[model samples]
Target: MPRARVSLLSLGSVRQGLRDSIRHLQSSSARASSTSPNEVEHSDFATEVEINDLPDGSAASERIAKAIGCSVNDLNAYFDPADPSTLSITAKSLKASPQMRTSLLEWRQNIPPISLRTERAKKAYRRPIGLNAAFEKALKVLTVDKHEKYERILRLTDKVEGIINQFNVKAIDEIPVQKKRSEAYLTAGLIRKLRIDAEINFPEVTSQFEMGKFDMRLPVYQHLVRARWEKNDRLLLIDRMESMHVIPDTLPTLYPQVDVKVRFPGTNTFWIDPGRVMSTGVTASEPKFSIQMFEDSTKLFTIVIVDPDTPDLLTDSYKTTLHYILSDISISGNSPLVDKANANELVSYLPPHPEKNSGYHRYAVWVFEQPNCEPLSTEKLASFDLQNRDSFDIRRFSQLYGLKAVGAHFWRNKYDSRTESVREKYGLPQGLVYSHKRYQHYEDYAWALPDLEVGDENKA
Candidate 1:
């Protein structure tokens, strides 16, 4: 019968039939490989509707029940918990049900494991080496048990928080009275002690406490501040002074033990950098001084600001002019801000007014510690008048007062557009513009000139 109904097929029809057969074979092989012999095959629809049943007293069942705050049997109808192989199925169920996910999260947060809490607390309060040995030993003796240590940390944290909240509102200027400031420093001292003894991170509280201490100039945190100055600012100041000849020109030498900061209030509120060039207008106003002393004991200090670039036409050399001088100034680690009320203004502030065509002038600020906190006599103070300020000798002044230089700072100024206005305001005389002088030269000898006639003859 097949021979009688034989039909000729085209090449295209044969290729299409072969492709269909290969595709069918691939599909069958894939279906067979998808399900292992041990695995039970279920329909996709059936899997979506199916629920795994949890056995009693299983670990997974207990965990799910605890997390969801429900009995294991109560949740058995909706999802599988005891079957370890149905993890993906349970995850999908949890993802689909927001109520279940939220409940599980709440349960976890409400009842964290005791072991985890202990481990976390220990890690958070771990002590670092290289700290003060005596302080660490004291802490160890006080907090022998974990519970004791944690409780102590909590108490100190509360105390520090209270102190910060109390003083954070008031500024340094607002708390002008010494008695109230002393009380604030006492509280800050307590915070410092806690920080050193606890040896634990206090995050925001520690930083706030430090800011308070710095503003109040408390001695408790002076070491940290001193260390910072010694490591960076001190070295930079020394380098600038030595390189610019401010050292020998102003003073013999400097061995700074304190940190000196200079700022012009109306012009710039920020502290001026060491050896920075300032405009005549910016330096016109009296500068604010902050002398950070490392010593705890209060002592009298003398601040001398001199310009070592003033021109003396008579001698054809530069003379050091006293720009400003304050005597009987009190300063210490616990009180760093310069108090002008208790100070004697030897020479009123004379703003820098460099002459036209003159180079940069160095305004050297020297802080000298007095021998016995003695005030300058009236005679000595009167001697530093405007006339006497023109030729000031710092070496002689320091020798007379028996003063030791503890801190030094300097800034530069040059003639600018505002120099004229400053000169007028200070009633200074007109500045003379200097020009380079030309010198006369002798005529050259006849033999020194080139022989033009001989060269012309050689060319011919």
Candidate 2:
């Protein structure tokens, strides 16, 4: 059984400790730091806890909750949300092992603000302002390999044909916006039809588009694959759902129990806290884990680790912030991540480290079974190459390549001193907290593991 949690900072000292920690931080850097691993506030944490930039306690509490992986409700149970000590105490309550707790502190300290990150994005990517988003999306969809592109063009052709058929006639005298949409769809449909015709070279239409013939058609960017999120509803404990069919339900049984362990620079590796809230420092590299397979060695698998919470928690406006994608594996009776060479790693595993002051996030790993296709063969998997990672949709990716959910699990991570650095590395936005104190209705219930044949592995 997991031990009952206790706070290291006393209530009487919390207020004072926070202030002292803040002052100590301001002396070190322009930012303010507040959390400590244990009762003793570490100087390393002082550099990372930047409360000075935060306007108030509401902001501080939100940051504390996210940084330590506790609900605002949980953090408040120990101290005022704004208090820096709230983070330290809340982490204590969660029983985060000492080494992981310290890494959380360090990770939080290293975070950079939006201004800096935006600046970094501008300098690093040099994304031309007038590059045309809609055109770019269309180009991405159209220019892929023959197999995938053929299917996409067909799907688009069908959709546009239906829309065009809905309009009894080409009402050229319609309003500007309406006419624009109609013409674009008509033109997009025409282009798809034309692409198949050997006589019409690609240059004619593209050259005409460059010359401003049916310019609106350039904006025809449609997602080819849209699959259901069957697992999101299970994660929905909120009183109300903002959008239906956005997230899926959670699986009760993590069929093949996966043990995810984090290696700390300070201490020995430990089994991840069953609760899954982790410090940013501990997540810099890909996590090492051992999976218990169901004696099926022939199956090929794909593992996608994604953070669906970005910019905020309630809605996935930013969609999934992909961290890792390892595909095409031959499970040899029970070997851990095999053949680093054979697997298709679309995105190298960047660890989860949410920005400071952002709401708590859910970082999940989804495992899909490539039953029919030779996932190992690059020739077979060529159709699945998504040129851009921004549009990566796991559900679509799974359905597109005939992969089904085999086994999956996820852990949570929030901001820490090293978070700023991680965010800077990924060119992410600064943490944003719209409101204070997310409810703790589910609280400790989130970690309930289902009973399996190996019963002992069920517990974290």
Candidate 3:
């Protein structure tokens, strides 16, 4: 009995210490010269937490309660009975260990099932308290190193759990999102469709998005690939999500600045070109464009294409095409082959071929001249090519180039809160929550893991 009590106290204290470390790092890492490993681990861990809505009647929860030798009512008491969406355990009231730290295994095996069920709620409540979220909040925490690196071990465990959850691993993945109610099975009786036996498994790419895994992003992009390579029973290649790593965008800086020329906005009849940049066309017959310069003041030209007819098998099926014309201000030449006189300027467009298509595909093409032009080599875009180059993979490119991507256009769903800027949706939302303290920027009960120091890196 004393051993059990000691285990509980150690678990609670270590949890508290971790929370303290995480909060401290999240709050002060930006201002401090150095940050603790505990802090970064917590932030990364918080991201992997799956906030799913638990059913009011969880057979699993009931079975767990029975396995632990606790009465149903006693088990329920330990969890939050009010919010059926979550089982919440209050960490604030728990007893702490005399040593004020706990081992990873203790919490996993010792914590009653009912107590585990309330983890989400407890985590939510403890966000402001500064726990090392990555250590304590994972579905399953495992490690061989537990000396001074206890915090990092915890963070890695969280990451491992998140990877498992992202790929929908049954026993390992425990985080739950909101439940979906789809009655489309009503058409089960009218089932008359082609059958395809397909196998799905998450492939280890970078550890986050397994190649074998099937997620919303994969299906959506595959649909785009189908539309792109239409007319064959070809298989589209999509990599796992783990290939994504957070890095600053680097392209916009290559040029001092370039003018943005608008040629055409997409229309109902035509979808935007994936290869060309959009420009405002002054006239339908002569087609004039409005140009805006970036910080470098280099004159740039653009072309736009809108193709509404592209088969949108996926819910997000609209497409925009961009064609960029960059001119080198240093070069001077007169050429009739091209309307632009700058010898340094080059025109590049995508969907590489438009004339070959028999169907009506709308495309916009605009030309602009920049004060200075920095040529982008093929090697710069090699990753994009490997990743299918075209599709919903726009964010990955913009992120790499440090370019403020002006979205061509996309289908809006009910869940989309248009109030947030596009950059926030694609790039900065997580950063915003992590960087700031005011809760108003985020939602109630929605807290971010504090900033953490990575490896031996000092605070920025």
Candidate 4:
């Protein structure tokens, strides 16, 4: 009976039937393998089974036996699946008869290959194909591979992968573990840190976004390698935001900056680097950065601290809001902002308040070298309001007043409840939280003083 019919029988009968089937297969295999030419003369059982299993059955066996000048029984006994000699002998006989050889070759070619019998399995994300020829060759070397040096690469590849494996991003979990968004974030970040030598395309990306292209394993690693090779990539690329569109890394746009050695004065007593984040009130308090002004103390200079990430990050409606500006400030060999007695107060410093819902904000500082002992005129200067200024332009201001940027740097800021007291001190009325849905934006209060008066006094 067929196996389907056997299953419908009683439970005991089903068990017995399965055992019989398994035993039958095993015995047939064993008997087939053990058969020999000498023993087969005494027993026709194995010979009959082997002849039946052949493609042409007994007819092919007899033909092979006649071609080899052997008895049909001997021919079957001598046949071994592992030995190619028996197949060759059969083929020789089949070739002697052209009609049989043609039929055999046609059947052989029509049979499906072993590899094709099984279904093909595919990966969720397909990595971009073809490695850089030199990189591929370098990777295959055993010594380089053992050192883990070849793995780092930063090709401006248009693909990335496997960041959002859909909630299966558990670092530790049972079944149905979803991947965290941070995994993708961290993977992209590591690429910005790794060492690799490759060119970064500054041209506007016209095609698809590269980060979501392939699996994170190799693509993330390549970016890390490339990032490290970049001059200031490690210093500037602090988070996932900068890695996406790295306009901050370009120097020509904002060139020749002053060395801003940042130090958080609070209890944490930590120094600040690019992308380094401090808490809202404690460490994120107004950071004091010291820059040695080679110019004479009597000479006037301008210091403008602005935030480019104003009015929400997505839509940068307000590009560079003049947060704190000190025009005609005294700069000595020592720090200029140190002594309030000599320093002019055009715009006082205000701590960054990212608000509860708002994301990370970049609080940048731009130091401009003012005109060298010339007639300081407020007539030509653009009418700038500290309280009601819209999109402020740094380059335009520099050109108008014969000012050049001397030094520049920025640190990241985020929101926390600890900043509540600080916000009150800054007299924040409206708050940085303009809207929660489309991301909170910085209102006028966040960028400037409520009511600030502009002075045309020329201390120079």
Candidate 5:
């Protein structure tokens, strides 16, 4: 019976039938190998034996001779090369045979070598075609494989979710067992101290914002690095209105300078070197002073200061250099203001609110050539006191200085009605002004009031 029919029988009978089929195949293979000569042969050609190994007309030699398609004498021909009676076949001997050569040539032609060559060419060309088709088939197979992989991945994810849910349940049950106790020494006092320290440094931040679980690992660097628990970037703990206190106003668009010294003698003028500083901690509160050109003339002039390095400080008297652009007296008209005034008054007008302009005034002198450059106009000099002023005198002094106009702004002292008696006595207007006297060499004029003692005044 067929194996399928055997399966429909009883279970015990089915097991016996499978055992019998397996035994039958094994016995048939063994009997075939043992009994059959051709089946037992190692190669496709007839088996042969050496002459030296043959026994004289024995059963074994006869059996061996019978196995080959030749007699014993024919086998002897293979061993004897020089014997006139011997016949042998070797590769060279075969090539010399005309029959073999003609047969081989005919056989080669019948094989259709050109067709074989064409077939080979086709096979070579078809390789890429077959490869491409196989590649496309492989791509389709890969796509199916990918789909299967994705399905497997989805199943794996579902399994992972199930595992996670089981773990979460177990974790919930073990939560109380794993609960960590608070440190014994931790108290409200320590918390308060920590909060107080944080509040002192970060007053804008809050206690609620500062509260956090202390990172035990970062305890060493807690005080060095500035940090807080708050997420918001900026905080205004107090209202702007409540924090309102009067701040010193900035005198906009003007650089304030202190004249430490000038070229003239008698008056003490201390010029701080641009390279020098009182300290790295002190920075310029005023805008930087720069020079601009006036196209009207060629005048070489400069504001030189005493090198703070010479005296080790700016308190000592300074030296300055002022080069004259013009030598002809005829070009400059006779005016007393030209000699008496300083550059400050010539550059700007005094503001009505003198308090607003109070500080060290800078006088940035520059040189420019001129057919004319937008006429020397004053934009910030709105409070000029020009009761007895002459335009020629102001212009001459401006030309002499090499700058279009002096740029003046005060930063050293706050302008007060009483403290600055010159403003009160001379009827000086309270804003920026263009005045001749403001540019006079500091040595020729008392650059500052007596209140600014400047111990080196006696030397000047």
Candidate 6:
């Protein structure tokens, strides 16, 4: 048999013709079954083809044409305005030949109906027009740009992961202290270099670098965290401290190098926002603290919490009252949590209970780096008492102890429903309710009597 002539007709026309032939075959078989009860039923086609095989376009069309003993060009002509008798004869021949019916059924099964194709596939194959064309082109350009950005981010992330993996081979604690410190410093420098490159080259995508494995000790995360602090947290801290007078009121001036976070355990588990107004009930318990030290080397530090607005009745002014003090706190970049067990508690925590009439009181939390990492002498530690805590002088205390202020955080507290209970719990004196002193009117005073009024000459 001659090879099927290649047809210029679309695949759609070929699929519709195949479907019509299959339908005709099915109807013819049903009619034949009704007419002759003695006729043996044909077995169902055994040749199974997957839907995926239908797209072998031209090759599949050629095979189907050859199986049917016809050319693709002849199949194409069946749809043309030709003699109706010729089309009917061709249909009858297709229905009579079992091989032709099988081939048509197989083709119909493998090729999915047009309605079954996905909308995405339809869009992909469909030609765009006018504004739709422009939109598709723009979409393609955006996809390519996004893909390039994603690849760049992946490369940077891979570099970061490689650096992290190099040092992460050994447990951080197992390493020798000296070697660990040196390695930490070196890793920090390398990570910082990469971070700088990312910021300069792709500032918008720099945040993508922080997507994976976050280890605070690893410089990869640490540097990013530090950058975030500098850009956002640090500025907020300074603005609150200065605007709220936490700077001059508690300490002379503050330049925070480390990040100090404080949270009252019984009240809030999360770190409290700086300069927030907290109620007495929430601030009743001793606060837990986390201090992030940028330096690698461990250093002894002191933490002090003072209420600068403590009421001084006799003086008629406010005085600094030391509410809590912890000395000799060993802190490093890796070890941030304040371990109360190891630190010396110079003064135990005293919850803030501002009196009913007293205004909002500033509770300043100050962190001072101990000079030479020397523990405070027992004499000095013992000297801190209720008497000493009252009217506390933080500046003089820092000077005497050679402590340099490194970090500070504070919040305001005022009289609330729980203040009375807090005062009673601490066995403190009952707060006095103060009122503004009343002044006599000039008309009511004896010195301003109408009879004692000065004459015009006296006025002159």
Clashes of each: 0, 28, 79, 22, 42, 0
How far out, in Å, is residue 186 in model 6? 13
Write candidate 4's Cα lDDT for 291-407 as tens digits.
Answer: 544222344566677666566332344456666766665554434343445445566666676666667777666666666534335676536455543466656666777776666
Give the number of the best model, judged by lDDT. Answer: 1
What digit string (tens of lDDT, one per residue) describes model 2 on residues 165-199? Answer: 46543422221357655564465645444333311
Please write out the lDDT profile of model 3 over residues 239-272, one tens digit for every residue.
Answer: 1001111011111111212222233333523432
The global Cα lDDT (0 to 1) of model 3 is 0.29
Whole-model Cα lDDT of every candidate shown, in order: 0.64, 0.47, 0.29, 0.45, 0.28, 0.63
What value of lDDT does candidate 2 attain over all alpha carbons?
0.47
Q: What is the lDDT of residue 121 in candidate 4?
A: 24
lDDT (tens digit, per residue) of candidate 6 on 287-394:
989899764457788999999998664344788898988989988778899999999887888889887777889999999888666787767655545346789888
* RMSD each, Å: 29.3, 32.9, 28.8, 27.2, 37.5, 22.2
Ranking by lDDT: 1, 6, 2, 4, 3, 5
> Best TM-score goes to which candidate?
1
Give the TM-score (vs. native) of candidate 5. Answer: 0.16
How far off is residue 374 in model 5, in Å?
A: 17
lDDT value, residue 148 of candidate 3: 22
Please give the TM-score that candidate 6 achieves against the real structure: 0.53
| Candidates in descending TM-score order | 1, 6, 4, 2, 3, 5
| lDDT of predicted model 5 | 0.28
Residue 10 C-alpha lDDT in model 4: 22
How well does each candidate superpose onto the true structure, as a TM-score? Answer: 0.55, 0.36, 0.19, 0.37, 0.16, 0.53
